[model samples]
Target: MSSTETATLSVPGANLSYTVRGSGPVLLLIHGGNGDANVYAGIAEHLAERYTVVTYDRRGYSRSKLDNAAKEYSLETHSEDIHRLLTELTCEPAYVFGSSAGAIIGLELACHYPGQIHTLIAHEPPLTHLLSGDEQVHARHIQENLEITAQREGIVPAIRQFATLLGLDQSNGSSGRPNVEQLERLLANMNYFVMREAPAIRRHTLDLETLKTVWNGASMRIVIGGGRASYGTFPYQCAVALARQLGLEIVEFPGNHLGYVHQSQEFAMRLHIALQD
Candidate 1:
Protein backbone atom coordinates (compact mmCIF):
# COMPACT_ATOMS: atom_id res chain seq x y z
CA MET A 1 0.00 0.00 0.00
CA SER A 2 1.17 3.53 -0.81
CA SER A 3 1.45 6.04 1.98
CA THR A 4 0.98 9.75 1.57
CA GLU A 5 0.90 12.91 3.66
CA THR A 6 0.19 16.55 2.89
CA ALA A 7 1.31 19.64 4.73
CA THR A 8 1.72 23.39 4.47
CA LEU A 9 4.88 25.38 5.02
CA SER A 10 5.29 29.08 5.66
CA VAL A 11 7.93 30.53 3.43
CA PRO A 12 9.14 34.10 2.93
CA GLY A 13 6.22 35.43 0.88
CA ALA A 14 4.12 32.36 0.27
CA ASN A 15 2.38 29.44 1.92
CA LEU A 16 3.50 26.26 0.19
CA SER A 17 1.40 23.13 -0.08
CA TYR A 18 3.48 19.97 -0.37
CA THR A 19 3.00 16.21 -0.40
CA VAL A 20 5.27 13.42 0.85
CA ARG A 21 4.99 9.82 -0.18
CA GLY A 22 6.54 6.39 0.42
CA SER A 23 9.83 6.20 2.33
CA GLY A 24 13.60 6.07 1.98
CA PRO A 25 16.11 8.71 0.98
CA VAL A 26 14.68 12.15 0.18
CA LEU A 27 13.94 13.05 -3.42
CA LEU A 28 12.53 16.48 -4.15
CA LEU A 29 10.65 17.15 -7.37
CA ILE A 30 10.12 20.65 -8.67
CA HIS A 31 7.50 21.31 -11.33
CA GLY A 32 7.93 23.57 -14.34
CA GLY A 33 5.68 25.85 -16.40
CA ASN A 34 1.92 25.70 -15.77
CA GLY A 35 2.47 23.00 -13.15
CA ASP A 36 1.95 22.33 -9.46
CA ALA A 37 2.92 19.54 -7.08
CA ASN A 38 0.57 17.17 -8.85
CA VAL A 39 2.66 17.46 -12.01
CA TYR A 40 4.84 14.59 -10.77
CA ALA A 41 1.97 12.36 -9.72
CA GLY A 42 2.95 9.44 -11.95
CA ILE A 43 6.73 9.63 -11.61
CA ALA A 44 6.53 10.22 -7.88
CA GLU A 45 4.36 7.15 -7.50
CA HIS A 46 7.03 4.96 -9.04
CA LEU A 47 9.99 6.57 -7.34
CA ALA A 48 8.26 6.49 -4.00
CA GLU A 49 8.89 2.77 -3.86
CA ARG A 50 12.49 3.46 -2.89
CA TYR A 51 12.55 7.19 -2.34
CA THR A 52 10.68 9.51 -0.05
CA VAL A 53 9.38 11.74 -2.83
CA VAL A 54 8.51 15.32 -2.02
CA THR A 55 6.50 17.46 -4.42
CA TYR A 56 5.13 20.90 -3.88
CA ASP A 57 3.13 23.63 -5.60
CA ARG A 58 5.60 26.43 -6.08
CA ARG A 59 4.89 29.87 -4.65
CA GLY A 60 1.95 31.67 -6.26
CA TYR A 61 0.85 28.49 -8.05
CA SER A 62 -2.18 26.34 -7.30
CA ARG A 63 -2.45 25.63 -3.57
CA SER A 64 0.76 27.51 -2.85
CA LYS A 65 -0.39 31.12 -2.58
CA LEU A 66 1.65 34.22 -2.02
CA ASP A 67 1.11 36.57 0.90
CA ASN A 68 1.51 39.43 -1.53
CA ALA A 69 0.16 38.35 -4.87
CA ALA A 70 1.44 41.49 -6.54
CA LYS A 71 4.99 40.93 -5.37
CA GLU A 72 7.53 40.34 -8.11
CA TYR A 73 9.05 36.86 -8.20
CA SER A 74 12.74 35.98 -8.52
CA LEU A 75 14.83 32.82 -8.75
CA GLU A 76 16.64 33.79 -5.54
CA THR A 77 13.42 33.85 -3.56
CA HIS A 78 12.32 30.55 -5.05
CA SER A 79 15.61 28.88 -4.19
CA GLU A 80 15.45 30.24 -0.67
CA ASP A 81 12.03 28.68 -0.30
CA ILE A 82 13.42 25.30 -1.29
CA HIS A 83 16.21 25.72 1.23
CA ARG A 84 13.73 26.50 3.98
CA LEU A 85 11.62 23.48 3.08
CA LEU A 86 14.63 21.18 3.18
CA THR A 87 15.70 22.60 6.51
CA GLU A 88 12.29 21.80 7.89
CA LEU A 89 11.99 18.38 6.30
CA THR A 90 15.33 16.75 7.13
CA CYS A 91 18.90 17.37 8.11
CA GLU A 92 20.29 14.98 5.53
CA PRO A 93 20.99 16.23 2.02
CA ALA A 94 18.35 15.37 -0.61
CA TYR A 95 18.23 14.54 -4.30
CA VAL A 96 16.52 17.13 -6.52
CA PHE A 97 14.87 16.80 -9.93
CA GLY A 98 13.70 19.94 -11.67
CA SER A 99 12.39 20.73 -15.17
CA SER A 100 12.39 23.98 -17.16
CA ALA A 101 11.97 26.98 -14.85
CA GLY A 102 12.13 24.64 -11.90
CA ALA A 103 15.48 23.44 -13.24
CA ILE A 104 16.67 27.02 -13.08
CA ILE A 105 15.58 27.10 -9.47
CA GLY A 106 17.61 23.96 -8.82
CA LEU A 107 20.66 25.60 -10.36
CA GLU A 108 20.20 28.56 -8.06
CA LEU A 109 19.89 26.29 -5.07
CA ALA A 110 22.98 24.36 -6.09
CA CYS A 111 24.91 27.59 -6.39
CA HIS A 112 23.71 29.15 -3.15
CA TYR A 113 23.01 26.21 -0.84
CA PRO A 114 25.22 23.42 -2.07
CA GLY A 115 25.14 21.44 1.16
CA GLN A 116 21.41 20.92 0.97
CA ILE A 117 21.45 18.97 -2.27
CA HIS A 118 23.18 15.62 -2.76
CA THR A 119 22.50 15.37 -6.48
CA LEU A 120 20.61 17.79 -8.69
CA ILE A 121 19.22 16.68 -12.07
CA ALA A 122 18.23 19.87 -13.87
CA HIS A 123 16.29 19.01 -17.01
CA GLU A 124 16.01 21.66 -19.74
CA PRO A 125 16.78 24.76 -17.74
CA PRO A 126 16.08 27.81 -19.99
CA LEU A 127 19.29 29.68 -19.33
CA THR A 128 19.05 32.18 -22.17
CA HIS A 129 22.13 33.98 -20.88
CA LEU A 130 24.16 31.01 -22.13
CA LEU A 131 23.34 31.98 -25.71
CA SER A 132 25.49 34.42 -27.67
CA GLY A 133 25.11 37.50 -29.86
CA ASP A 134 22.06 37.35 -32.08
CA GLU A 135 20.75 34.19 -30.48
CA GLN A 136 20.73 35.79 -27.02
CA VAL A 137 19.09 38.92 -28.41
CA HIS A 138 16.41 36.88 -30.17
CA ALA A 139 15.64 34.85 -27.03
CA ARG A 140 15.29 38.01 -24.94
CA HIS A 141 13.05 39.54 -27.59
CA ILE A 142 10.65 36.64 -27.37
CA GLN A 143 10.55 36.88 -23.57
CA GLU A 144 9.92 40.62 -23.65
CA ASN A 145 7.22 40.13 -26.26
CA LEU A 146 5.59 37.39 -24.22
CA GLU A 147 5.54 39.60 -21.12
CA ILE A 148 3.93 42.41 -23.08
CA THR A 149 1.37 40.08 -24.60
CA ALA A 150 0.49 38.64 -21.21
CA GLN A 151 -0.06 42.10 -19.79
CA ARG A 152 -1.90 43.51 -22.79
CA GLU A 153 -3.83 40.61 -24.32
CA GLY A 154 -3.99 38.29 -21.30
CA ILE A 155 -2.59 34.84 -20.59
CA VAL A 156 -4.50 32.74 -23.11
CA PRO A 157 -3.03 34.47 -26.12
CA ALA A 158 0.35 34.69 -24.43
CA ILE A 159 0.29 30.94 -23.83
CA ARG A 160 -0.49 30.24 -27.49
CA GLN A 161 2.37 32.46 -28.52
CA PHE A 162 4.67 30.78 -26.02
CA ALA A 163 3.80 27.37 -27.43
CA THR A 164 4.40 28.51 -30.97
CA LEU A 165 7.66 30.23 -30.10
CA LEU A 166 8.98 27.12 -28.30
CA GLY A 167 7.90 24.93 -31.25
CA LEU A 168 5.70 22.99 -28.87
CA ASP A 169 2.80 23.52 -31.23
CA GLN A 170 4.26 20.98 -33.65
CA SER A 171 2.23 17.77 -33.55
CA ASN A 172 5.14 15.38 -34.05
CA GLY A 173 7.28 14.89 -30.95
CA SER A 174 5.19 17.56 -29.28
CA SER A 175 4.87 17.23 -25.53
CA GLY A 176 1.57 15.38 -25.33
CA ARG A 177 -1.39 17.57 -24.48
CA PRO A 178 -2.56 17.68 -20.89
CA ASN A 179 -5.92 16.10 -20.15
CA VAL A 180 -8.98 18.35 -19.86
CA GLU A 181 -8.75 18.53 -16.05
CA GLN A 182 -5.02 19.20 -16.13
CA LEU A 183 -5.54 21.80 -18.84
CA GLU A 184 -8.09 23.54 -16.65
CA ARG A 185 -5.61 23.65 -13.79
CA LEU A 186 -2.91 24.97 -16.13
CA LEU A 187 -5.22 27.69 -17.43
CA ALA A 188 -6.01 28.67 -13.86
CA ASN A 189 -2.30 29.28 -13.17
CA MET A 190 -1.44 30.80 -16.55
CA ASN A 191 -1.52 34.34 -15.26
CA TYR A 192 0.92 33.65 -12.45
CA PHE A 193 3.30 31.60 -14.60
CA VAL A 194 3.36 33.77 -17.72
CA MET A 195 3.20 37.12 -16.01
CA ARG A 196 5.38 36.35 -13.00
CA GLU A 197 7.49 33.21 -13.34
CA ALA A 198 8.28 33.44 -17.04
CA PRO A 199 9.60 36.98 -16.74
CA ALA A 200 11.68 36.02 -13.72
CA ILE A 201 13.20 33.13 -15.67
CA ARG A 202 14.07 35.30 -18.64
CA ARG A 203 15.70 38.00 -16.54
CA HIS A 204 17.73 35.79 -14.22
CA THR A 205 21.42 35.20 -15.01
CA LEU A 206 23.46 32.32 -13.64
CA ASP A 207 26.68 33.10 -11.76
CA LEU A 208 29.10 30.90 -13.61
CA GLU A 209 32.07 31.80 -11.42
CA THR A 210 30.24 30.80 -8.27
CA LEU A 211 28.88 27.69 -9.97
CA LYS A 212 32.37 26.67 -11.04
CA THR A 213 33.73 27.26 -7.56
CA VAL A 214 31.04 25.04 -6.09
CA TRP A 215 31.55 22.34 -8.68
CA ASN A 216 35.28 22.36 -8.01
CA GLY A 217 34.62 21.80 -4.33
CA ALA A 218 32.83 18.56 -5.21
CA SER A 219 30.17 19.18 -2.59
CA MET A 220 27.36 17.89 -4.80
CA ARG A 221 26.80 16.25 -8.16
CA ILE A 222 25.09 18.42 -10.79
CA VAL A 223 23.58 16.88 -13.91
CA ILE A 224 22.13 18.69 -16.90
CA GLY A 225 19.40 16.81 -18.75
CA GLY A 226 17.48 17.21 -22.00
CA GLY A 227 14.75 15.16 -23.65
CA ARG A 228 15.44 13.18 -26.86
CA ALA A 229 12.69 14.87 -28.82
CA SER A 230 13.41 18.33 -27.44
CA TYR A 231 16.17 19.00 -29.95
CA GLY A 232 16.00 22.38 -31.73
CA THR A 233 14.20 23.92 -28.74
CA PHE A 234 15.64 26.84 -26.81
CA PRO A 235 15.60 24.99 -23.49
CA TYR A 236 17.47 22.02 -24.92
CA GLN A 237 20.04 24.31 -26.51
CA CYS A 238 20.43 26.06 -23.18
CA ALA A 239 21.05 22.72 -21.50
CA VAL A 240 23.65 21.83 -24.09
CA ALA A 241 25.38 25.19 -23.65
CA LEU A 242 25.42 24.83 -19.89
CA ALA A 243 26.94 21.35 -20.07
CA ARG A 244 29.68 22.69 -22.33
CA GLN A 245 30.38 25.45 -19.81
CA LEU A 246 30.64 22.97 -16.95
CA GLY A 247 32.52 20.34 -18.94
CA LEU A 248 29.71 17.90 -18.17
CA GLU A 249 27.75 15.64 -20.51
CA ILE A 250 24.04 16.20 -21.19
CA VAL A 251 21.84 13.40 -19.82
CA GLU A 252 19.05 12.57 -22.24
CA PHE A 253 15.68 11.72 -20.77
CA PRO A 254 12.64 10.18 -22.48
CA GLY A 255 10.17 12.10 -24.70
CA ASN A 256 10.28 15.88 -25.12
CA HIS A 257 10.40 18.81 -22.73
CA LEU A 258 7.51 17.59 -20.65
CA GLY A 259 8.59 13.93 -20.75
CA TYR A 260 8.07 13.54 -17.03
CA VAL A 261 4.41 14.26 -17.64
CA HIS A 262 3.77 12.31 -20.85
CA GLN A 263 6.18 9.44 -20.32
CA SER A 264 6.21 9.17 -16.55
CA GLN A 265 7.06 5.46 -16.33
CA GLU A 266 9.91 5.59 -18.77
CA PHE A 267 10.99 8.91 -17.31
CA ALA A 268 11.04 7.43 -13.83
CA MET A 269 13.13 4.46 -14.93
CA ARG A 270 15.54 6.68 -16.84
CA LEU A 271 15.75 9.08 -13.92
CA HIS A 272 16.80 6.20 -11.66
CA ILE A 273 19.58 5.29 -14.06
CA ALA A 274 20.65 8.91 -14.37
CA LEU A 275 20.70 9.35 -10.62
CA GLN A 276 22.84 6.26 -10.19
CA ASP A 277 25.26 7.35 -12.89
Candidate 2:
Protein backbone atom coordinates (compact mmCIF):
# COMPACT_ATOMS: atom_id res chain seq x y z
CA MET A 1 0.00 0.00 0.00
CA SER A 2 1.19 3.49 -0.78
CA SER A 3 1.93 5.69 2.20
CA THR A 4 -0.54 8.57 2.51
CA GLU A 5 0.89 12.06 2.99
CA THR A 6 -1.13 14.96 4.35
CA ALA A 7 -0.63 18.60 3.41
CA THR A 8 -2.26 21.99 3.26
CA LEU A 9 -2.55 24.70 0.63
CA SER A 10 -3.16 28.34 1.40
CA VAL A 11 -5.88 29.70 -0.84
CA PRO A 12 -7.93 32.84 -0.82
CA GLY A 13 -10.28 32.89 2.20
CA ALA A 14 -9.20 29.47 3.41
CA ASN A 15 -6.38 27.06 4.07
CA LEU A 16 -7.31 23.82 2.31
CA SER A 17 -6.43 20.48 3.91
CA TYR A 18 -5.49 17.82 1.34
CA THR A 19 -4.01 14.34 1.05
CA VAL A 20 -1.84 12.62 -1.56
CA ARG A 21 -1.23 8.90 -2.06
CA GLY A 22 0.75 6.81 -4.59
CA SER A 23 2.52 8.25 -7.60
CA GLY A 24 2.30 9.10 -11.35
CA PRO A 25 -0.08 11.58 -12.95
CA VAL A 26 -2.26 13.50 -10.48
CA LEU A 27 -5.90 12.48 -9.97
CA LEU A 28 -7.81 14.88 -7.70
CA LEU A 29 -10.97 13.70 -5.97
CA ILE A 30 -13.41 16.39 -4.96
CA HIS A 31 -16.04 15.46 -2.38
CA GLY A 32 -19.68 16.54 -2.13
CA GLY A 33 -21.72 18.16 0.67
CA ASN A 34 -20.63 17.33 4.24
CA GLY A 35 -17.72 15.28 2.88
CA ASP A 36 -14.06 15.89 3.55
CA ALA A 37 -10.69 14.56 2.33
CA ASN A 38 -11.12 11.32 4.26
CA VAL A 39 -14.37 10.55 2.43
CA TYR A 40 -12.36 9.02 -0.45
CA ALA A 41 -10.10 6.86 1.77
CA GLY A 42 -11.58 3.54 0.63
CA ILE A 43 -11.17 4.08 -3.14
CA ALA A 44 -8.05 6.25 -3.02
CA GLU A 45 -5.94 3.23 -2.03
CA HIS A 46 -6.95 1.36 -5.17
CA LEU A 47 -6.57 4.36 -7.49
CA ALA A 48 -3.23 5.25 -5.86
CA GLU A 49 -1.64 2.22 -7.51
CA ARG A 50 -1.70 3.98 -10.89
CA TYR A 51 -2.04 7.65 -10.08
CA THR A 52 -1.07 10.16 -7.41
CA VAL A 53 -4.55 10.28 -5.94
CA VAL A 54 -5.36 13.60 -4.27
CA THR A 55 -8.32 14.34 -2.05
CA TYR A 56 -9.14 17.52 -0.18
CA ASP A 57 -11.57 18.95 2.33
CA ARG A 58 -13.52 21.65 0.60
CA ARG A 59 -13.55 24.91 2.62
CA GLY A 60 -15.35 24.82 5.97
CA TYR A 61 -15.85 21.06 5.80
CA SER A 62 -13.24 19.58 8.12
CA ARG A 63 -9.53 20.33 8.45
CA SER A 64 -9.89 23.04 5.81
CA LYS A 65 -10.36 26.33 7.68
CA LEU A 66 -12.04 29.39 6.34
CA ASP A 67 -10.49 32.77 7.13
CA ASN A 68 -13.92 34.16 7.78
CA ALA A 69 -16.25 32.02 9.86
CA ALA A 70 -19.14 33.28 7.80
CA LYS A 71 -17.47 33.11 4.40
CA GLU A 72 -20.03 32.73 1.65
CA TYR A 73 -19.68 29.52 -0.39
CA SER A 74 -20.22 29.39 -4.11
CA LEU A 75 -19.31 27.12 -7.02
CA GLU A 76 -17.05 29.78 -8.48
CA THR A 77 -15.15 30.07 -5.19
CA HIS A 78 -14.87 26.29 -4.82
CA SER A 79 -13.77 26.00 -8.46
CA GLU A 80 -11.09 28.62 -7.95
CA ASP A 81 -9.85 26.75 -4.88
CA ILE A 82 -9.42 23.60 -7.01
CA HIS A 83 -7.67 25.56 -9.77
CA ARG A 84 -5.19 26.92 -7.29
CA LEU A 85 -4.61 23.47 -5.77
CA LEU A 86 -3.88 21.94 -9.19
CA THR A 87 -1.68 24.87 -10.17
CA GLU A 88 0.29 24.52 -6.94
CA LEU A 89 0.65 20.75 -7.27
CA THR A 90 1.19 20.14 -11.00
CA CYS A 91 2.37 21.91 -14.12
CA GLU A 92 0.56 19.47 -16.40
CA PRO A 93 -3.17 19.09 -16.78
CA ALA A 94 -4.67 16.86 -14.08
CA TYR A 95 -7.51 14.36 -14.00
CA VAL A 96 -10.48 15.39 -11.81
CA PHE A 97 -13.36 13.35 -10.38
CA GLY A 98 -16.01 15.36 -8.59
CA SER A 99 -19.24 13.93 -7.15
CA SER A 100 -22.52 15.82 -6.48
CA ALA A 101 -21.81 19.43 -5.53
CA GLY A 102 -18.17 18.66 -6.15
CA ALA A 103 -19.09 17.71 -9.72
CA ILE A 104 -20.75 21.09 -10.13
CA ILE A 105 -17.53 22.68 -8.84
CA GLY A 106 -15.53 20.60 -11.34
CA LEU A 107 -17.66 21.93 -14.19
CA GLU A 108 -17.06 25.47 -12.99
CA LEU A 109 -13.31 24.79 -12.75
CA ALA A 110 -13.17 23.28 -16.23
CA CYS A 111 -15.10 26.21 -17.58
CA HIS A 112 -12.68 28.78 -16.14
CA TYR A 113 -9.43 26.84 -16.55
CA PRO A 114 -9.70 24.40 -19.43
CA GLY A 115 -5.90 24.15 -19.72
CA GLN A 116 -5.63 22.93 -16.10
CA ILE A 117 -7.84 19.87 -16.60
CA HIS A 118 -7.11 16.79 -18.73
CA THR A 119 -10.36 14.90 -18.30
CA LEU A 120 -13.17 15.54 -15.83
CA ILE A 121 -15.57 12.76 -14.76
CA ALA A 122 -18.42 14.64 -13.10
CA HIS A 123 -20.64 12.21 -11.19
CA GLU A 124 -24.23 13.23 -10.43
CA PRO A 125 -23.90 16.98 -10.39
CA PRO A 126 -27.19 18.53 -9.23
CA LEU A 127 -27.47 20.90 -12.11
CA THR A 128 -31.09 21.97 -11.60
CA HIS A 129 -30.40 24.79 -14.06
CA LEU A 130 -30.05 22.28 -16.91
CA LEU A 131 -33.51 20.81 -16.32
CA SER A 132 -36.34 22.00 -18.60
CA GLY A 133 -39.40 23.99 -17.47
CA ASP A 134 -41.48 21.86 -15.12
CA GLU A 135 -38.56 19.61 -14.25
CA GLN A 136 -36.51 22.62 -13.22
CA VAL A 137 -39.38 24.04 -11.20
CA HIS A 138 -40.02 20.73 -9.50
CA ALA A 139 -36.37 20.19 -8.59
CA ARG A 140 -36.10 23.68 -7.10
CA HIS A 141 -39.35 23.16 -5.26
CA ILE A 142 -37.98 19.98 -3.71
CA GLN A 143 -34.84 21.84 -2.67
CA GLU A 144 -36.91 24.63 -1.15
CA ASN A 145 -39.04 22.18 0.79
CA LEU A 146 -35.88 20.47 2.01
CA GLU A 147 -34.69 23.82 3.39
CA ILE A 148 -37.99 24.21 5.15
CA THR A 149 -37.59 20.72 6.60
CA ALA A 150 -34.13 21.58 7.83
CA GLN A 151 -35.35 24.83 9.36
CA ARG A 152 -38.58 23.60 10.93
CA GLU A 153 -38.09 19.87 11.56
CA GLY A 154 -34.31 19.95 12.10
CA ILE A 155 -31.18 18.54 10.36
CA VAL A 156 -31.88 14.85 11.11
CA PRO A 157 -35.20 14.67 9.27
CA ALA A 158 -33.84 16.97 6.58
CA ILE A 159 -30.83 14.69 6.07
CA ARG A 160 -33.12 11.69 5.68
CA GLN A 161 -35.08 13.56 3.05
CA PHE A 162 -31.83 14.68 1.48
CA ALA A 163 -30.77 11.04 1.24
CA THR A 164 -34.06 10.18 -0.42
CA LEU A 165 -33.60 13.06 -2.84
CA LEU A 166 -30.27 11.52 -3.87
CA GLY A 167 -31.87 8.05 -4.36
CA LEU A 168 -29.83 6.45 -1.59
CA ASP A 169 -31.12 3.40 0.25
CA GLN A 170 -30.82 3.85 3.99
CA SER A 171 -30.77 0.08 4.53
CA ASN A 172 -27.71 -0.43 2.32
CA GLY A 173 -25.95 2.76 3.50
CA SER A 174 -22.14 2.44 3.28
CA SER A 175 -20.28 -0.75 2.29
CA GLY A 176 -17.75 -0.26 5.09
CA ARG A 177 -18.48 0.24 8.75
CA PRO A 178 -19.05 3.81 9.75
CA ASN A 179 -16.41 5.63 11.74
CA VAL A 180 -17.80 7.28 14.87
CA GLU A 181 -15.59 10.33 14.50
CA GLN A 182 -16.47 10.80 10.84
CA LEU A 183 -20.17 10.43 11.57
CA GLU A 184 -19.93 13.10 14.27
CA ARG A 185 -18.16 15.42 11.89
CA LEU A 186 -20.83 14.75 9.26
CA LEU A 187 -23.49 15.57 11.82
CA ALA A 188 -21.69 18.75 12.75
CA ASN A 189 -21.54 19.74 9.11
CA MET A 190 -25.24 19.10 8.58
CA ASN A 191 -26.39 22.57 9.54
CA TYR A 192 -23.71 24.26 7.42
CA PHE A 193 -24.47 22.03 4.45
CA VAL A 194 -28.18 22.78 4.71
CA MET A 195 -27.92 26.50 5.44
CA ARG A 196 -24.95 27.37 3.24
CA GLU A 197 -23.58 24.77 0.81
CA ALA A 198 -26.95 23.60 -0.45
CA PRO A 199 -28.10 27.14 -1.19
CA ALA A 200 -24.81 27.94 -2.92
CA ILE A 201 -25.22 24.91 -5.17
CA ARG A 202 -28.75 25.99 -6.03
CA ARG A 203 -27.57 29.47 -7.04
CA HIS A 204 -24.79 28.18 -9.28
CA THR A 205 -25.21 28.20 -13.07
CA LEU A 206 -22.67 26.60 -15.39
CA ASP A 207 -21.37 28.42 -18.45
CA LEU A 208 -22.93 26.16 -21.03
CA GLU A 209 -21.43 27.91 -24.03
CA THR A 210 -17.91 27.64 -22.64
CA LEU A 211 -18.43 24.00 -21.66
CA LYS A 212 -19.76 23.17 -25.14
CA THR A 213 -16.75 24.80 -26.76
CA VAL A 214 -14.32 22.92 -24.51
CA TRP A 215 -16.07 19.56 -25.06
CA ASN A 216 -16.12 20.07 -28.83
CA GLY A 217 -12.34 20.41 -28.89
CA ALA A 218 -9.55 18.27 -27.34
CA SER A 219 -8.52 20.65 -24.60
CA MET A 220 -10.48 18.64 -22.07
CA ARG A 221 -12.70 15.56 -22.21
CA ILE A 222 -15.81 15.98 -20.05
CA VAL A 223 -17.62 12.78 -19.10
CA ILE A 224 -20.89 12.64 -17.18
CA GLY A 225 -21.22 9.79 -14.68
CA GLY A 226 -24.39 8.52 -13.02
CA GLY A 227 -24.90 5.58 -10.70
CA ARG A 228 -27.10 2.77 -12.06
CA ALA A 229 -29.06 2.60 -8.81
CA SER A 230 -29.66 6.36 -8.92
CA TYR A 231 -31.67 6.24 -12.15
CA GLY A 232 -34.65 8.69 -12.31
CA THR A 233 -33.35 10.70 -9.33
CA PHE A 234 -33.02 14.45 -9.80
CA PRO A 235 -29.22 14.37 -9.76
CA TYR A 236 -29.07 11.46 -12.20
CA GLN A 237 -31.60 13.16 -14.46
CA CYS A 238 -29.47 16.29 -14.30
CA ALA A 239 -26.46 14.20 -15.32
CA VAL A 240 -28.39 12.75 -18.28
CA ALA A 241 -29.40 16.25 -19.32
CA LEU A 242 -25.78 17.39 -19.10
CA ALA A 243 -24.57 14.50 -21.25
CA ARG A 244 -27.27 15.17 -23.82
CA GLN A 245 -26.36 18.84 -23.94
CA LEU A 246 -22.69 17.95 -24.38
CA GLY A 247 -23.44 15.20 -26.92
CA LEU A 248 -21.69 12.63 -24.74
CA GLU A 249 -22.86 9.36 -23.18
CA ILE A 250 -23.49 9.13 -19.43
CA VAL A 251 -21.29 6.41 -17.90
CA GLU A 252 -23.09 4.24 -15.36
CA PHE A 253 -21.34 3.35 -12.13
CA PRO A 254 -22.30 0.95 -9.33
CA GLY A 255 -24.71 1.74 -6.46
CA ASN A 256 -26.59 4.97 -5.89
CA HIS A 257 -25.66 8.65 -5.31
CA LEU A 258 -23.14 7.80 -2.59
CA GLY A 259 -21.58 5.12 -4.80
CA TYR A 260 -18.03 6.22 -4.01
CA VAL A 261 -18.70 5.46 -0.36
CA HIS A 262 -21.00 2.43 -0.67
CA GLN A 263 -19.33 0.87 -3.72
CA SER A 264 -15.81 2.23 -3.43
CA GLN A 265 -13.96 -0.62 -5.11
CA GLU A 266 -16.43 -0.89 -7.98
CA PHE A 267 -16.70 2.85 -8.30
CA ALA A 268 -12.91 3.12 -8.50
CA MET A 269 -12.80 0.47 -11.20
CA ARG A 270 -15.50 2.23 -13.21
CA LEU A 271 -13.74 5.57 -12.73
CA HIS A 272 -10.40 4.08 -13.87
CA ILE A 273 -12.04 2.74 -17.02
CA ALA A 274 -13.66 6.10 -17.74
CA LEU A 275 -10.37 7.97 -17.23
CA GLN A 276 -8.59 5.48 -19.50
CA ASP A 277 -11.17 5.81 -22.26
Best by TM-score: 2
**lDDT of candidate 1 at residue 75, scale 0 to 100:** 82
lDDT value for model 2: 0.87
TM-score of each: 0.91, 0.93
Question: Residue by residue across 198-229, what tens digits does model 1's lDDT show?
Answer: 87888789999998898788668999999998
> What are the runs in model 2 whose C-alpha is more than 4 Å off?
170-184
Q: For residues 1-277, could you state the per-residue lDDT of candidate 2 as single tens digits?
A: 9988999999989999999999999999999884677768888999999999999999888788789978666778989999999998999999999999889999998888888899999999999999998888978987887789999999879978877776676532334666897677777667778888888788778889997777666578889999999887888989999999888899999988888887789989999999999
Clashes of 1: 0
How accurate locally is residue 16 in candidate 1, as Cα lDDT from 0 to 100?
A: 91
